[model samples]
Target chain A: MSSEISSRGPADHDVRDQIVIAATEHFSLYGYSKTTVSDLAKAIGFSKAYIYKFFESKQAIGEMICANCLQDIETEIRTAVNEVDGPSEKLRRLFKASVTASLRLFSDDRKLYEIAASAATEQWQAARDYEVRIKALLQDILLEGRQSGDFERKTPIDETATAIYLVLRPYLNPLLLQHNFDHADEAPTHLSSLVLRSLSP
Target chain B: MSSEISSRGPADHDVRDQIVIAATEHFSLYGYSKTTVSDLAKAIGFSKAYIYKFFESKQAIGEMICANCLQDIETEIRTAVNEVDGPSEKLRRLFKASVTASLRLFSDDRKLYEIAASAATEQWQAARDYEVRIKALLQDILLEGRQSGDFERKTPIDETATAIYLVLRPYLNPLLLQHNFDHADEAPTHLSSLVLRSLSP
Candidate 1:
């Protein structure tokens, strides 16, 4: 997140960012079940009370770390949106970027994502929240396509966008992503083409 | 399995079928880990030795029951294919049948589906096998569409169909199916329309 400083504006944003990084490292190196908030604070040269001042509980800190990882994908989507010339290209890039970025979280820290994928647990709420945000981002891209005439206007844009998100669920889902990663690692590319062709005017 | 009688030639089919039905009932009601082959044998008024003659282990019986359920779905797809007129209609019916049937597994027997979704376990192989058959069924639909000129012939039908399966993973996968089932309960309709629209010539 040191590279993401330009996206921040809060006075204490740096401190929170540092804490997030420290917590992520602690959770990764030692298991999340084994790491406590006090360990996070002690490793970051702060008191446990100070960590609590920012995050309500250990789960909250875990949520923040998950949220931060999600934001990294969001940033990647934003970059894709900005760099493209048309909505089709932007949508393609966004889909590809999101899949690649999300899969990176699993490959980078397998244990952390294993915790995140435990749908029966409380932390799954954070993962579901992240999914909603991703769907919203997809809707935004579809709306842009409708305005630019790259996509047809026959159906409601929201429905079409939501459908696209649903169709891409297998690629975006961490649990399903591993299966696609093996088949020449080309599901995102194939899916982006299928989606683009589906929307063409 | 009456229609599938040709798929087997053994005279002991009746006994095997009864044992399978008993085991499925036990697993569905009491959970897989708690259900044993001995209990299944007793429930069906069969000796443990006779039950062992059919299935080497309790898990083997469980796998057969799962395989039987999956075959029921395969029969559903076959009926849809034979009853439908066009490839587009066949694809639509196939998609809807798969989504609804997969979701039915979760809703109809949450305990059984829950065990199936635990992909880390050994029984996940059966689930994986079921997925491969579903994908093959999807490809068959796409192939018909391509041949009938209902869908474009530019892309490889296999890749395109695989992409569709990937996109609909949320609805088709037991783990993700439960989440979508609680939301609007109409994702199958929406997903079918989206996939069919994408395949149009």
Candidate 2:
């Protein structure tokens, strides 16, 4: 653990990437609280000082792991949403894919889900940032729907977007989703239909 | 404080009511965690032993305060819902009154709102019971709407009611509502319309 891996400068950009990957693995496998800076260094044959050269502290590493999870979700949302044409179908696919992506991300790695849950309770920067992204995504869909006359809104775009986000809570929010796991298959389909029906002119 | 308010036996029913009233004042004024059993005992002119005779702990007293708040909200909702005729109007008033009643409760007593927030985070028994009571209330309204041909449902009564609960969350959930206090008057109006429109035949 005392041995440093890099012949390159400690501030090297590659080292930062390595630190995030190793930290993500540790967070997703053993759990967030249990993983130490020392363990992160050992995972990549670096010393604690070298790890600090990249991430300021364990908390920063935790932030990076949460950011990584949201990024993964965002990428899937974009792909699913872009795959379709028109606002109505795009809204349906995008909303459904967000739930599906999160389920897959958490179900495959329980520890990552635990990290997400912890982030939510602690009100971590990453968690709040994730919400902004989702709301923006919904806002775009609603705006497009309104412009194209495919849907009508009962409120302004921001409020309508927020209402849609809240309505899909049981299927989208990981904490609430945990309680409704029995309806894992049916929830997205049912809730999305309710949302679409609400928007239909 | 050592002087007993009554050797009439700690089981006197009025003693229990007196304790709850004093505790609510202290909790609303000083704060839940700050208000101790000793403080409560002092407030009610009773000994600590007398306080313990009624509530097992400070936590129990906190639970009672939260339960009292929910009961107040329920009374308002029942009165408003029952006063109106037609399921649409009943549902509209029921949802609106729930938000309005909660806003009034939390506004007049910020510390009590804090207690409710704490109870929610701690998932206290009293909090869970309050949710069950609300869901039942919503279920009754939804069923009535369905039977009266004022509403059509895409799901069972329970799920529809739960979805309604989730949808009204921004306006109804104490924690979220605290941030949106400026919309205090408008939230119920907008959200109620959303709820009614969703339920429309």
Candidate 3:
């Protein structure tokens, strides 16, 4: 989606898209905290006023970039889970894929990861929304497992889903993930298996 | 226990104790980030060189303070676990006590908690040592449970302890705890129960 342009005119959309692209490049190269709106305008050959027309603030642009990055991770997790059969296998794949995708971001695109970390520390809407979606996915998996007699139904689905989310929260939240990244490679297998064991009837 | 004084003379111990007390008072009053070595020196009626003689730097002082804070939480956790008879109950109490002690620090001593948060974020020796202690405690609980025919013996004790510690990491690490404090109350109960369920023989 284009940025803050109120109108749907093609030219307006083009300008918004160009600004986002330029900002992403600038942010990646110099890092998010060091780059300012003025630096972005200079790098993108746009006036400060023009950039502001599309973005309300530097954090606004960061929010958009962070949202896109989170979406990429979500997509990878979904694809991995989809290839597996049974709710148990799907949940296992989901945990592994989630950790792998996030770790890749941390190693491959560290600058972007910084933005996500900041977003999480600030409790930005994007970070909160990402958590909500992950919990919803967990609930869906738990419901599926219950229906198939793969998981126990004694624990309320909502509490079960929330608990599972909390277990995964450290690895999912970039701020916490960076600290625990060393153990992350083996964590998914161990954690998912343990959780699956708990879910058994 | 005193600062870097090589000799264990009573006067050296007194000066070190004075510096620590003054620094803690300053930190609690103005927050760790806002106060400086010079501020502590001034507050304690000591020369800046004298303060540095005791602590290599501001962070060195912070490390001691942070270590003390973590030890307080550890003591609380141990007392809570010891009050229980069974491994399951002990583990559950350990989880709850850890969260409660940390949350208390966050609420009652926000400034001190900031120092602990900084220590965790920086991965100071104090923070790492605290984690190692907690994991060791977890291993002990798991081993006890296994011995009593409570926890399953199928999973390796080391691996299971590590997994449980990871689950509890967010609630224990002050940097991450601040973000998840909203869920801290219910988390220990739900999480410990889930973990206990998995451990059942």
Candidate 4:
């Protein structure tokens, strides 16, 4: 990875991706407070000054990582919804995708989730922006389901989407980062059942 | 509070209670790593020797505080269940009381919840003990409702109770401490509807 980065031009997009990958590992291991730019630079074989050239600060790097993870999750959810046939199947796939994405993101580096949660409280603007984007994505799926006559939801789609996110948050949130991932399987199962039951005709 | 302590005999129980209260505030403020026996001693206006006389270490003091908080919550829940008239009402009151107690305990001290969540990971024994006690309490309530025909649950009461707790946990867990308590009012409204809808014959 270091050799690839050295071979690339300074302005190459791959360099940015490499930095994010390294930062993700560092942040996961040391958490936000302990993960310095110097450590990230060292991990990726880049100078601290070069790291700052691409990302303004450690917080900026963290924000990018968060956005990247959430964006990937959103894409997966959209693809899953598009591929599945029925309302029940759609809901199952949607939640399964969410759980899988969330678990995968947090599985290797649990501290990233903790940092995200802390960022939500400490950095209101970024956190709220991320939340709005997520809520909109959820709303779109629900609206799509309703339009297809597969889901008969009486509650406002947006409100119901927000509620579902809030209700499933404990399982999704970073605070559960320390819990054994193997044991966390029950959450997605129960949550999918509850949401499907609520939305069932 | 100090006067009340002074009035009690200088027995080990009184000393232990005083230390626990002080420890709660200390743990609530700086969390476990930062909270020290000296800080707790200072908070209680006691010497380090006196502190050690009642508690073995800072970790033990933390354990005691958690034990007391859990006991208080369990007692409140049991009392609420007994005082309420019917299953629906009992369930509602139980939810209300649990939320209220959680809010009261951590309302002014958000770090307490953080400490608890962190402690759950750092101290596995305490976490398992706490989980078992809570499960038993919820199981008892579910059994009572089933015996009275107030709940039409086909699943084993223990499993059903665990499911209900998991569903309610996002709202109640300390990690989501930043949540608006006003939203809690809406939670039970939604939860009761879900419960009634699921369990109604």
Candidate that scores best on lDDT:
3
Q: In model 1 chain B, where is the ten-residue run with the lowest total lDDT?
A: B114-123
Clashing pairs in 4: none
lDDT string for model 2 (B120-200, tens) is 767789878887887787788788888878887665666667657765654555655655565566666656666666666
Global Cα lDDT for candidate 4: 0.67
Cα-based TM-score, every candidate:
0.78, 0.65, 0.85, 0.70
| DockQ score for candidate 1 | 0.46
Q: Can you write out model 1's per-residue Cα lDDT over B1-201, one digit (the tens) per residue?
A: 875666555746877888888777877888878767777778888999999877788867777777776777667767866787988888778767777677667777876775556542353567779888878878877887888889888877777877787666666666556545543366667777887778878
Model 1 local distance difference test score? 0.74
Docking class of 4: incorrect
Weakest 10 consecutive residues of candidate 2 chain A by summed lDDT: A1-10
For each candidate, the DockQ is 0.46, 0.12, 0.51, 0.22
Candidate 3 residue-wise lDDT, B65-138, digit = tens: 88888898899999999998999999999889999998998999999998998987788999999999988888
Worst 10 residues of 2 chain B by lDDT: B1-10
Q: Compared with the true structure, what per-residue lDDT tens digits does model 3 show for residues A1-201?
A: 555345557886788778888888889999999999999999999999988988899999999889889999999988998898999999999889989998988999888888998998898889889989888888888999999999999888888887888888878889778877767988998889889878978
> Who is ahead in DockQ, 3 or 4?
3
Ranking by TM-score: 3, 1, 4, 2
Mind giving the per-residue lDDT tens digits that candidate 1 earns over A51-131? 887778888778877766667767877787688877788888877787777788778888677556553245367678877
Fnat values, one per model, are 0.52, 0.06, 0.46, 0.12
CA lDDT, every model vs. true structure: 0.74, 0.76, 0.88, 0.67
**Pairwise TM-score winner, candidates 2 and 3:** 3
Question: What tens digits encode model 2's per-residue C-alpha lDDT throughout A133-162?
Answer: 877888888899998998875567766666
